[model samples]
Target chain A: MRVLSSNLRLFWQGTLLSYRALFHWLRPAQYVASKVFMPLAQMFFFVFLGTFATSASNAGFYIIGNAIQITAVSGIFGVTMSVGGERETGTLPYLFGTPANRLVTFFGRAFMHILDGMLGVVIAFAWGVILLGLDLSHTDLPALALTIAVTTVSTCGLGLLMGCLSLITVNVMFVNSFVYFLLLIFSGANVPIAELPNWMQAISYALPLTRGIAAARLLVGGAPLADVAPLLWTELGVGLIYGLIGYVLFSWFEFIAKRRGILEVF
Target chain B: MNVRVLFKYWRTILIVAEMTIRQQLMDGFIIFTVLFQPIIIALLALWMLKGKGPDYAIFVVVGSGLTGLWSSLLFISGNSINAERWSGTLEPLVAIPTPFEVIIFGKNLANVIQSLLSMVLGYIVAAFFFGYDLTIVQPWYFAVSLALSVFAFISFGLIIAPVFVMNPGVRAWQNAMEFPVYLLCGFLFPIALLPGWTTPISYLLPPYWAAVSLHGATTVGTAPNEIFFAWGMMVLFSLIDLLVASRLFKLMLYKARADATLGME
Candidate 1:
């Protein structure tokens, strides 16, 4: 209980520090413009394109898909960029030298981003319904919420992987953009997985968001939680795998950085 | 300007373009965008149009490729000055004897030259991977339309580059401008699918003119008059953008020197 309490304290502290750093770096207005308004416009663009390509009934597919994909924006971009920012600001070495559990510290900073990403999805979905009149009356709200939770954790695991990779990689942003576009295409965010080639479809199944997006579509179509359990389980398994791999990679890189004493180099 | 000064200016622009190309090549962000973005966008579009026949596949390939060009111009060329500012070169560049606009013009040219790879990559993907027909309606006309499209987009980049240099907030504005322009300019789809009210706005943007001209030349049975109309509109928009950009450049220079805000952002 004491250990759990301490971890919880670290988590809240990391979340507050992340928010404070964010506000300090960007003005409130700029943050809102980039984080809020920009995502809304992105959603509007895809929703309209989906409508043109398919029909109004398919808008929910895009609405939910894009909403969830927003997690990538926050999860992947946010996590990697946070590490990049630390490196740029010359605090990375100090961060590594600290005695605290690295995973707890990193996860604490990254934790709120999952919520931020979910907020993006919620905002996009709400905007879709209000502006585009997306029909959500048939959706299973509980199932939808579960899908969101799984999607956030799964994508955030990938984000953690990206953050860990940033320590050793020279061009983490490039990797982030590559993963971002890959997800956009392969995660059934824009195109249906069925539309992809067999190999591509197989690749999608291995990706973090593909199963979660499938579950999301089912929930949006009013499917029961029991119906989406398999997908949810698959997504959870993928998330766990990514999380474990990320933690291992992060620890290995941290050890290497300390041995080489080049952690300060950008 | 005198003939000697004109020669000197042209030489400076070439030197800047040469250096900018080398610098951009070493930039991971620029290279990633240039190489990966177009292919992914084109592939995604192709997947969406899987059963829409080979002709539509050709349209999507070309459209997605050109959309990549536009995005590169906006994010890379448009933010070139901002990048220079962050690197502490903007102040020295401004202090140079040559007009800064000349340097930016060189940068824009280099960017467009680099972006042409997207077109080639798109064609290669379509022809080899997707197995779409590689024929054009009027090869010479298409070639001319393509050249004009690059020129028109270069002019568009010039206009935004100044706005980006002058206002830090314009970075957010540029980010905000991206997808909307992609939709409005009919980069991947026909603008007719959009509401009627947006038509005039699309007419005013250079990308729309480029798309129409390129698409007109690519698609068979497009009336001869329609092709020429696209070419004419492209030139008109290019001229207008150049004029507007010149004014903005002057204003930006004046403010930058006066306030010493060239490196502010």
Candidate 2:
């Protein structure tokens, strides 16, 4: 009980501190512009293009997919920056010297981002319904919400893996932006997965948001929660695998840093 | 900001442009901004608009190319002065005998010129990968339109660089500003698809005129009068932007020198 209580406290503090440190510098207006307006604008652009390509009736497909994909704003960039920022800001040394549990610290970095990412998706969905005339009358709202949460967490899982790469590279932003945009294509946000070539479809399934997006689409199409269970489960599992790999990488990096005395050398 | 001054320092401008292009090529972020991002956008667009048939290939190529141009202008050229400040060269550069705006013009020239490669890359991708036989219907007209669009974009950038330097709040809104312009400027699709209220806003943007001219130049059936009108609008905007940028540059330099905030963010 005592160990659990202490770990919980550490997790909470680290989660809040890292998130604040990363974004609190931006004024509220700037935050709203970046966090709120930017994703909405992006959603509008794709939704318009999608409708133009086919017809106005197809707007819902893009509205949902992009709204869900917006979580990656928090997942990929936000979470990656939280972890990578330690190295960039020269705090890695102090972090390493501390005797806290590495698991708590590592996973804690993504906790606030998961919640933040969920809110972003929710906002995107709200804008979709309000501005773009997305009809959700038939959707199982709870299932769709579940899909959003699952998708955000899964995307953040990939973010964790990308964050570990930041420890060794100076071009973390480049990597993060590249992966984020690739997800825009590979995850079936803009282009339909079925329309893609066989090899591209294979890559889609390997990605985190693929199942989550498909699941969300089905739920919005009025499918019951049970119908998307397998997809949600697969999405969660894929995220777990990525997160575990990230953990392994994080541990390996820590070990190497200590032995070689290069905790923040790069 | 007088157009004549640019000609006076032509040699210096070219040297600065060459150096800026060389330095920026080595940066991964710049490379992604100017080249890879547009290519990826083109790929996604070609796939998304696949149902629109082959006529839309040149549209995607040109649209995605404008995306690269706008992105390069917003980020790289918009930060030209700030980039100098960051590298601790702003003061020395200002102290030099050459006019400050002249050097920045050269840098913008490099950024805009390098960004054109995004269109070339998009053309290749559309031609070879997507197997679309891309052609410019009026090659000379398209060439002239492209040159005017580059100058207009450079002039527009001159205003943004100083404004962002003077106002960090405005700079913070940079990411949010990107896609709206792409949408408003009718980069990939017609702005008529947008609401009626946005038409006036579209006309207010220089890139909208660029799109009209470029897209008009690509189709064999478009009226030459429409293309010429777009060129007129671009030239008008360029003049207005240059005048506005001149005032902004003067005010920015004064504040930076007076407040001793040149080295500060």
DockQ of each two-chain model: 0.54, 0.80
Q: Tens-digit lDDT track for model 1 on A12-123?
A: 8866776567545555656666567767767766776676666667777788788878778777877667655667667777778777667787777567777887887788
**Candidate 1 — which residues are off by over 4 angstroms?**
A1-6, A19-25, A55-57, B1-8
Tens digit of per-residue lDDT, candidate 1, span B1-265:
1224335799887888899899889777788777678888888777666656677666776687687788789889899788788888888888888977778878988888788788788888888998888777688888998899887888789888888777767665665676778788887777787779999999888888788878877787778788788889988877787778878988987887888777786
Candidate 1: lDDT of B231? 86
Among the numbered candidates, top TM-score falls to 2
Cα error of candidate 1 at position A259, Å? 1.3
Worst ten in a row by lDDT for model 1 chain A: A22-31
Worst 10 residues of 2 chain B by lDDT: B245-254
Q: Encode model 2's per-residue lDDT on A10-36: one tens digit a residue.
A: 999999999989886547767777788
